[model samples]
Target chain A: MRRFSWFNATSLTLGFAFLYMPMVILIIYSFNESKLVTVWAGFSTKWYGELLQNEAFLSAAWVTAKVAVASSTIATVLGTMAAYVLVRAGRFRGRTLFSGMIYAPLVMPEVITGLSLLLLFIGIGLDRGVMTIILAHTTFSMCYVSVVVSSRLVSFDRSLEEAALDLGCSPFEAFRLVTLPIIAPAVISGWLLAFTLSLDDLVIASFTSGPSATTLPIKIFSAVRLGVSPEINALSTIMIGIVTVGVITASLISKRASLRLQAEEQAAART
Target chain B: MRRLLLISVPYLWLLALFLVPFFIVLKISLSDTALAIPPYTPTLDLGAGWAGLKGFFAELDLENFWFLTTDDLYWKAYLSSVWIALFSTLLTLIVGYPIAYGMAQAREEWRPTLMMLVILPFWTSFLIRVYSWMGILSQEGVLNQFLMWSGVISDPLMILNTNTAVYIGIVYTYLPFMILPIYAALEKLDISLIEAAEDLGCSRFQAFWLVTVPLSKNGIIAGCFLVFIPALGEFVIPSLLGGSQTLMIGKVLWEEFFNNRDWPVASAVAVILLLILIIPIILFQRNEQKQREAEG
Candidate 1:
């Protein structure tokens, strides 16, 4: 182990504070009893109760849930197949183009993507609703799912699947017996990532959704313009809790994998 | 045949939905801004038998493209968005680099906690995070209140309804983007390079400036591009924080399409924005390809 110092420890503290202070305030304020925001009248769960009573928000949450589940499942299946082809085939024409097209929406200015999609929908005379939202969400999300599953498939030792094939199993049967179980984690991770993205999305969903199909972000957006109420803070706080847990879990898993790699490297050096 | 079938499905979906939408935008940009649904009818000869702008739609005139070029407001919005995005990206790099550096130094157990903290904001709704800053920086908000309480000022600061607010919002939202990529590069860096620099009669600060900064450039560039492009088209952070005083091209485009119901000009603006965005992307891809070939 390397020598530690006050300077290094202090910076870590400061970094964590910078990252989490706003969220801390949000969670704290969620329990504040004041109807008027920014005032800490007292601590209470009144607003969380109020959040429970919001039928519209509940219904909006339901819509967002439907979109997330539907879109993420579709994205996971499509993305996994694409990933398998790109990695297993070793080479293919137009794979890069396909990857680029799928991923473009991921980083493209949402304004451009959203506007273009909106224009397309309106031009085609398609009604803006759940279907449009699902389509737009799935397009970008498939990229993430594909990347996750594909990266895992890339480094995987192929001999295991080949052995299963040699033992009188067909390619499909061998894959079901071997690769499927191994790559299942990647599929789950991709599904989770897509689910969160679809849940948290506002910009694309806004353009594609009709009046009857507002998501949570749209609801919070419209209500926020009215004023800062504790209800908004409460919702934000709950969202922060879920995402914080997810990010921590992902980081731990990745770090553990790297550590395992390092241990193997050290063992090889000894030999 | 199985491989081909696997490939074609995603390809067709992208062609039908993703690529086609941009084509639709391109087609609309070519038409006159006459609020046409599917965009028919060219410019009218008002003097002869008043119809639409047949002159505008004519390939010879290129009237709509010319109009976007000459429009001062459109150009100003474009310029302002670019400048602001530049500043925000630069700011995020400055702040995020140090934090990433410090994280790279932490113990293995501690690094994940730190990374989780960085990505925590990502899990929440982006709009809500931007909205939360509204509470923090508003006139009666925490920032102004702290300033007043500490006698930093007698009155509340006019920080909310200005470009300053937009800057704050952009930096707040995008700092994560800059930090994550930089951290990835820095974390993967071999630490002995620093020792190598130190062994060569370099001080710690000098070692970092000499070795670390150059090593982190690719990540910095990727982070900056990620932040800058999105910052270019950001509507929510600017509008919510800057309020009505902010006239970003995004808002301008939104107004033309939704409020003004002028699809043609709106499409023109979208085309222009897409053109601007595509420049960086093509350049980045080409550079990455070059780097790959050099390594190969």
Candidate 2:
């Protein structure tokens, strides 16, 4: 057996505390009742009520929700199509370039991305608004979606596709009818991924977005410069709750599907 | 064969939107800083330029490109960004490795739960999380309140609006980015290899060093890049946390382009920033290619 020492215990405690202490503090203070952030008065949810009634923040959040939905929806289809092309298009000229192009944003600095898009819109004389923000968000988010979709695309059984074509169905029909169902989940997850990315983004949104096109993040950022209150913590706790529930649900669904895949494989072997 | 064109359409869309935008940035960066509406004067003439193109490319200049190095503030910001990014990445590794190891060692069923825990932050808005740190670390905030409540000090500690806050903010936001890839790497590690090391009379530490650490190096590298690259250009964290004291390249770039409206200088800074990052990016791609080849 490995040796257990006091030093090890201390270090582990420090490590765990370092990882979780801030989050603990944030959650605890979310319930602070007083407007005075320094003092511990009591507990309340008034800040949440305040958040609900704040029309400016609510509308900005609504705009953010709309952008996430529209951009992610567009990105899912485009990204899946891009992945299909990348995976199914075969080795050809510009394939390397095409792949590199998709990944450029992954490593490219956000300042560059934001600047380039800003300059592009200005040069084209296009008005800066939600439309521009949506376009920019989709550009980077689509790369992420494509990468995810194509990984699953690589693991797919090609013979199933080939067999469908042999059974008197056109290539498009075969893909639409056969391949779509198997890969549709990846596409949906890609959309979720895109939605999260769009929601999280601030720099790209800041650059392309006009004064009227404020995202929740941008709004929070501007408000935060004045100093943070418990209201921000309350907002975070709610966000954490939503995201935690979403991720747990996804993990459960994924676990079920993987188990089902294994069981089907085993049953096939028995046959 | 006819199906190939259908496949190509998606890429064409990216080329038109994504690629074209950068191409335009490249174009504007090459042009002279004029007082035109777009504030660009197209030369299309290099005048025996760096690339030595005559008619089609004579409008570009190496003046703005070479002129960037002369600015002391720009270099200072660059150095500051590099320092912050490196330190934050190092801090993340120190904190993340143990959790990754624990998660990797857990039962298969438990591993997914741990992974979901790490990824739960990503599902929420990062902007909110960073802002959450701002609240926690501010002078009159919970951190100070708690410290004072415990009678640990006579007065509140002035922690906010400093370089320390910038580091805290960055690590808070990026810790999961560092953790996930490492956890993914550690999970796929072969248990038998570690067992073999143990059977050969190696201690747990030795087993980790000899068997586990080397195996997960790719994940470590990927995790470092994932944090470092973004942190290098991070704006929101430094801007909010550092206030006026923190000067990073990203903030400088923002001030130059947006605040001062100096488009040419901003693009010049961007060009240099891209040039600096290309080597590391290429190395990252090469490693990714090697990993893919091994897996394939």
Candidate 3:
């Protein structure tokens, strides 16, 4: 008769604690005045201030942003196309091959992807930098985008597109007027996912990045490798802060949108 | 023309950037090592026509693959990577399944927030999460300090730079991958089915074992592969948290490339790793295909 069992409650609590405890500790200790990470010598915002002044970290952040923006945009476009082709392009030659490439990157190890792309650049005598990094990120992240968009495409109403085409809309116009609008949300989500994947990447960036194209993750990894610094903790806390705000805002917006849609549906039913 | 253009956009992008690069890695895996810029001989310089192709073919050999066979360390690193990855996948599933099931059964309003928490860490920098563990598990880290302060132990534990830390890091990082898929499967389960089973004299535990476990098998498999594949090639976690003693294939590939500057052997390691992963990759794709067919 118990709905929320004690077992489930315990597991959820323990799992969440396990997940968040380390991050919480890291964030709290980032505020410590002491240079030593373990011993607290009163709280201060000095680490955050120091982080802002660190030119290397700032440049890395800038480079990361640039690569993320570029790669995600490119990935979204190509991925949407790929998803549409897979869903609509009937009996296309080499369909198996196309789908294989799409799914391969989703499960491909970052190390292998990184190494392969690095070798490709070297084989062709191309320079390694932000551009090459963008290429590498786009190659991997497009698989994610395709997966997201294709799921949406699968459940989409075919009649809507048929009606648009029957009403004298060209095929492209039918797609633009009907299909694209409906799938826009999925595509947007795909783009955001790709953006984060690019932003969060370390191995691929490290492999492909040349001089003057260090990413935030690469820089952070090097710093952490050398030793744990309070500044790194401060930076991580800020990153967590940004992610929390973004996720909250996204969920709220989606919740409101779904509620509005339900209300509209109810009104339509009443009429 | 439009269809062609639409298809070719992604197809060509992937062909150029993804597929071609893999072939290049395959090619590089065969070539000999060098000390010059680019650091490998017998470049596949196709622009130079047939003569260049002939030269490239002439320089290619199985030397790097042979080198891998001769080195015991490479074999150990690879076997250890697979061993660690498999165990961690099981661990992630054990820790993640209950949380995912709880989230599925939670109030509809609460489910989204719970899912968001699972995904939020994924959005944060992966390296930072690994770095957070370094702080917790180090000899003089917060964990040891707390235990010492509480009089739990007189001496600090050597948790960092060990295989245990690697497992902890992998499980922590990849837990969401296990959770999300299982939650997706569990969320779609019909409450009526469980009720039906209960009415048939099946206890709740039996109902769960017979009904839930059987139903969620696909998700479990998918989630395991999701955790296992990347965990196999996880360079960052092993390198950052694990010591030199932890011999993961990723770390070995990295050392061979950067420290030894042996691109051919590194590529060979990667090629072998990919060959090993191909089985799981194929199985994952087939599972996805079966799901799609079922949905249709």
Candidate 4:
């Protein structure tokens, strides 16, 4: 089974390098004291220091975090509900339409989605601002959350809930006490996915955002469009660092949880 | 009652926000551009009920959609977007297939780490990834500097602000979308199937071609749709990496709506794009439904 063939090794190495090399270069050059993005000078932390003092970038980061938190929270609630219904509610009226709406956002072009949302806001006389952006973000991101949670729900053991019901637990009680806890990890991951989607969105935010609601991606886009600078490199490196740490921590947590679950199962089997 | 409450909340939200907006776009597309807030007219006044509806219907015209057809720029943008999306999807398949296959073939102990490696970059900021390429592909960028320093070329190659850059940016950003699905499909695949194929009269290449490729067809189609659909409407990559002559409909729509302030035309562009995308969208939905059924 251990096929360490030349072809497999080469393809994997090349693919990973192609995937990772740009970020590595960006991170390395972030420390370069040279003003030019490509040039290498003596290493310094001046760009990072400058980045800290930049009011606009900091404000944009704050706005982005606020939107991400709000949108992901709402999307999680709605998406979790949607997922449960899709998986457990059995066939109902408008099931096709419900499922269609759920999946449509996943593949819909950002331009059309953004444009349509913006127009909806305008037609309804809602001012384009943070609220509108949150609404727009929630609309799209909930689909990702639903897909994540629903997949988990699909293979879920329903007999557990049935046993709970047979033992005098109400359906709601059974779900709240038993089912929700089991699916909590998937729900959490769905929230995280939604949060990241909101944070990373530029085009939709660009369309729905007014003057006061500039997101981090929007700010970064405008700045990068002007020209690449050492400050942007510094900022990007910090972002990459944060994301790497977060992902590693998440994977570690899940790994530990799974390990504990395995230990419990083994103990039960032994008993 | 509880089930109904659960069902209606998300359904109503999507209806109001996601489903209803398209009608607004359609209505706006039919209306003439106006120098007023909300931009297009004649406005549908629900308060006026039937008379207003009749007035709005009367004002509605196909002029904007007609304009889209007549304009060479719009058609070029549409055609080129489809063309670029098609080729980039192919490029991603070529590059992604080996990585996905390798991951699927890797030892179980290392699979999680490999999966994490793939998913980690996907969760990072997409705009920053594209921006990173500006550094790599710009004339004075890293690649050029490295090539020049290594004496590979006396002159820096012009890779940035071209169709080539657009392709690279798209293929790079959308690579994860292509790989993850195929990886999932390949991971679910039984190695014994391949072994059995080999035990028969098939060579390794033949085994892969006959057994693995056909098996992964669902994932490949899903991946292609994932890459091709969004790439068709991609705004950021073409705007950032593509040159002035680059004719992506997303960029065109952005310019139309944001710069030119022509809501009717932009809405018309969107409507047409939706019409074009309807087939793929249905296909994607069908694929998903099939996968769900298979899983069940």
Candidate 5:
């Protein structure tokens, strides 16, 4: 057993404290009764109420949600297909370029991606709107989705897919029935990742979005640039709450699933 | 046919969106600025055939590239961005290594929860994370208030909207990128190797230096690249936290495009930025390739 030294304990504690302190402060300040974000007053939910009432913020939220759903869904399908091809397709022409495109965007700067995509839209005479934002989000987030799905695909048992094929199932049917179900968890996680990425993106969205559409990040960015406000604190708290719940729930579900699988395997061994 | 269909769908999507847009940026960078809607001249006219091609080729020049060279702002921004990225990447590594080592040495069952704690903030809004610092780092904000109360300082520190704040934001945000890869590497390390080193008359520090550090070199390389590459082109942290004096190329590119509305110049900036990035990017890719090969 590795001994846990005081040094390790201190480092871990300080590290986590550093990681979360700003967020904790922001969350606490969200309910400040005073308009000043930094000043303390008696706790109140006025900012939340005002946030709910702000039509612009609400509409921006609506647009963001719409974009997230549309983009992530399409990204998931396309990314899954990309992952399938990368793992299953053997020595096709331009294989190196195919994989290069897959990995390059993961590390590519958002400013570059956004700039290039905007120029493409303008050059092609495409109207910049919610549709353009969706296309841009789909293009980048699909790379993330493919990354997530492909890691799982790499470890997938090929024989199960082969067995389905041998049982008179067509290739498409085999994939739809056997491979899809088995990789559903990865695909779902990929979708979630894509969704969060789209939601969190401000730079790309700022470049691609027209006057017709604005995302929540863009709204928050413009507001925050004028300095911190109590309303933004409230919004941040709400966003943090949603993400905390989502991530915790996801980890819990995956944990429970693995535990159940372990128990089932142990029981089968006894039998 | 089925196999071909599966490959081509994604292959073509990436070609049209990713590859073609990149080429367009390259093309625009070589063109002259215009007052028209798209803001660049010599748009390809296939209708004019070979003559049009000749005209387009004639119009294209390295004028914008020359313009970038003449301006001190462009080169200075590039240099400062590289310097800032290098500095912050070092800072992230310093802060992250101990945390990652601590996690690797932690109790087995606590590892997952610890990992999740690190990732939870990542899943949250990045803008919010950067924005959250404003309330703490401002002149009259929490840090100053606390420091004053603790008698650590007599006056409020001017941190927000400064290069210092940009450093803080970059280190805070990219710390996770550094920690994860290092943690993965440290976790896979054989403790017995360190034990053997200690048993063979090496001191604890020497054992760590000889065994642990060398073993985790690949992780260190991966983590450094992960932090460095993104930090080099980071837009958000600098734009929000950095003052007007802060000169990051990403911010420069953004202002040139949106604020100045100079598409050709902006494209040239981006092209240069991409050129600067290509070296590190290729190194990162090669590192990833080597890691994969080692694992396989």
Candidate 6:
């Protein structure tokens, strides 16, 4: 048996505390009744109420949602296609370049990507609005989605796809009926990643957006540039809550799925 | 035809959106700044045929690049960005290594939950995570309050809007990137190797340094590159946490474009920044390729 030392225990406790303490403090301070952010007067939900009533925050939230949904959906399709080509398609012309393009944006500084995309928009006479933001978000986030999906595709069982082909299915039909169902989890996760990336983006959106559009990050950024505010804290807490719930639920579902699969395999072996 | 269509659709989309924009930035970097709507001189006038193309080529010069060399601010910003990225990457590794080792040493059944705990912060909004530090780092913030209350210090430390805050933010935000890779490496480590080393007359500390650290070198390399590359051009962290004294190239580029409206200068700055990043990025790619090959 491997021994767990006191050193290990202490490190783990301190590490997690360091990681979580800032956000924990922020969450606690969100309900402070005092106008001063640091001082504890009493607990109240007034900041949350104020956050809801702010028209600017509401519109920015709506804009962010629209961009996230539109961009992530489009990114998922393109990214999935890119992943399929990368994993399944044998060597083709410009394969190196194709792969490079897919991977470059994954690590490319957001400032450069945002600047280049903005220049492209200007050069092509495209207006900077929600549409431009969508385009920019889809372009970058697709790279992330492809990375997620392609990793899954790399480990996929090929015989399942080959069997569909043997059963007289066209390539498209085989993919749609067999491969899609199998890779649906990866694709969904890819979509979620793309969604969150678009939602969290500030620099790219800031570069691409005009007077006609503003994302939540941009709004929050401008607000916090001065200093911390309770309303912003409330907003941060809400975002943190949603993400925590989403991540926990997804992990639980996947865990249960694997457990059930393990049970089925054991039963099959027993018989 | 079907295969062709599938390849071409994404290929064309990337060509039009990703590849072309990069070329546009490159071209603009060579051109002079203009007061026009597009904000750069000598834009390609394809309608005028050969003469227009010739004229465009003739008009383009390396002035923007030259300007970058003459200006000390750009040079300082680039140098400072590298310094900050390197320093923060080291800090992240220090903070992350122990956590990764601890997680790897954890009970098998508890490992997955621990992994999820580390990843949960990653799934949350990065901006919010960074912004959360503001309330704590501010003069009247919780850290100061705690310190004063405990008689640890009589005065609040000046952390906000300083380079120290920027370092703290970078280390805080990029900690997971460091931890996850190292944990993956340490988890895959064979316990028997350490036991054998002990049997061979090495102490536990000696075994860790000689056997464990060398084995996990790939993870350490990957994690450092992951932190260093993004942190080099990090915008949000420095902009929010750093004061006027902070001089990262990313923030410089943002200011040049937005506050100064010098798109040509911004493009020039970006071009140079990409050049500096190319070496590290290539090395990172090679490392990833090697790891993938080993795994396969």
Question: Tens digit of lDDT per residue, candidate 1, span B192-294?
Answer: 8888899999998898899989887777887888788788888888878886767688878877766877777887888888788888777666655765595
lDDT of 2 by residue, B214-282 (tens): 999988998888888888888888888886868888888999887888788888888778887886777
Give lDDT per model, in order.
0.80, 0.80, 0.90, 0.92, 0.93, 0.93
- Backbone clashes (count) for model 5: 0
Clashing pairs in 3: none
Each candidate's interface RMSD: 2.2, 3.2, 1.9, 1.4, 1.0, 1.1
Candidate 5 per-residue lDDT, tens place, A9-120, comes to 9999999999999999999999999998778999999999999999999999999999999999999999999999889887888999999999888888899999999999
Residue-level lDDT for A42 in candidate 1: 91
lDDT of 4 by residue, B84-152 (tens): 999999999999999988888788899888888888899889998999999999999989989999999
Task: Output the worst ten-in-a-row residue range by lDDT, candidate 1 chain A.
Answer: A1-10
Over 4 Å off, model 4: A265-271, B190-203, B288-296
Question: Which tens-of-lDDT digit does each residue in B1-296 have in candidate 5?
Answer: 98888899888989988999999999999999999877889899999999999999999999999999999999999999999999999999999999999999999999999999998888989999999999999998999999999999998999998999999999999889999999999999988999999999999899989999999988899999999999999999998999999999999999999999998999999989989999998998789889989998
Better of 2 and 3 by TM-score: 3
Q: State which candidate, 4 or 6, has the greater lDDT.
A: 6
**Clash list (residue pairs), candidate 5:** none
List model 2 lDDT by residue over A81-124, tens digit each: 88987898878777887888788888888888999888878767
Best by DockQ: 5
Tens digits of per-residue lDDT for model 3, A170-222? 99899888898778778888998999899899989989999869999998888
Candidate 4 chain A: minimum summed lDDT over ten consecutive residues — where? A1-10
lDDT, candidate 4, A1-271, per-residue tens: 3344678778788989999999999999899988977778888999999999999999999999999999999999999999998999999999999999998888789999999999999888899989999999999999999999999998788998898999999988999987997788899889989998998999999999999889999999998887688889999999999888987887788778778877987997899
Per-model chain A TM = 0.87, 0.90, 0.95, 0.97, 0.96, 0.95
Question: If scored against the real structure, what TM-score would every candidate get?
Answer: 0.89, 0.90, 0.95, 0.96, 0.98, 0.98
Q: State how far residue B289 of model 1 sits from its true place (Å).
A: 4.3
| Tens-digit lDDT track of model 6 for A144-184 | 88889999899888998899999999988999998886677
Displacement of the residue A208 alpha carbon in candidate 2, Å: 0.8
